[model samples]
Target: MLRLISSIIFRLLFYRFPQLAYSQEEIEEYEKMYSKALTSKSEIKYSSNFPKLHFIQYIASTKKVVLHGSNHKGINEFEPRRQTLFNGKYEEAVFATRDGIWPIFYAVFDRNKLVGNFRNACISSDLKYNYYFFSLTRETILSNPWTSGMLYFLPEETFEKVNHSLVPFDEWISKSPVAPLTKIEVEPEDFYFINKVSYHNPKESVIVSWFLYKLRTKFFIKR
Candidate 1:
């Protein structure tokens, strides 16, 4: 058939003209970014310089996270992420599950430390961990040759970047149900981030985050 003839011709051409198949230039660009990330210092410094959407990763660890995401990727991706938050005197730690939550990556911010977390299992089952940041549009494990993770700016910056669409931080928080915004909605309307984060390919450990939600504030329905 014509398909068989085309296959034979294609193989013959590929073998005889190998240069036509490979682009060495593209590989060079990828390698440059790869080395730049490995050599960068502020990349791992306590203070970060990359933008909210720019990606970063740890040299010592396989984990990838957002540096400007107010110390967390999922939180910083919000339309208005917070910078300084007041923690309660009590040790406020608990499972911060959300409504209609899907299997995704979450970043936790605690005491200046940020960790990207994910879930592999459901909340109803034994509740095991998942490790993969999902690309909502691509529907695949989010990864890049230059950087493995991404970070979004804090809600304050978002407010500015989005043409002051958001109100003052104090006024915004006052309108919320709690003293501070805890659980954020990531629907298309609220935030149009192209990617949904978790983690990709986790090792033997609790990959999910216990500190993702704020430990300081709690909301009561008061029905």
Candidate 2:
């Protein structure tokens, strides 16, 4: 059983990280890069040199296709996460996140052009008993928005035990060592809102989703 479990875990890690396929000497180089990344500031380079920003925005543009009442996922999720949660928009769209690591985004579109996007992330629920965390979010723009901008978040605990796992906000806080880390605080599960916001209208949908890789906090986009 132990060998089987080990093999499965090893395969999963290898599948997620190409670096694991390298030799030990190469591993040391990766470690150096990781250490540098640890010290580097948290930022997404917006210049042409950084492909992530463009990719994320591109996804947002595509998301506007079915943004209206067609694939209306945000309509379904607003009840639970709202009235207690928060949201963020990429341009003009407003948004919020849901429980269970499920990512939801809303955007607005007009004449096949994206006008606004709302990107939201949620940190809700504490599964001390089940040992897992979950979240969901959706964004819709008043202009041209994707029919649905879908992103998924993994369990927060996965970041530590698995180096290849997506990093949660907790990881960044760990690196910076905030004063709140002294004691773990799990918010009440009574459908409390985590993060929510609404933005003004936009002339075009200038939002996109880059690679949903976890640097420290969960990141994603729909293109």
Residues 1-223, model 1: lDDT tens digits: 6544543433322111011122355344433443454455113222223221121221101122111212233331233233222121222121222112121123321212222322222121111211121211111222221112222211121121111111101111211111112212122222112222333223324322222211111221111
What TM-score goes with each of the models? 0.19, 0.19
Report the poorest 10 consecutive residues by lDDT, candidate 1: 162-171
Clashes of each: 15, 53
Whole-model alpha-carbon lDDT for candidate 2 = 0.24
**Which sections of candidate 1 miss by over 4 Å?**
1-23, 44-104, 107-223
lDDT of 1: 0.23
**TM-score of predicted structure 1:** 0.19
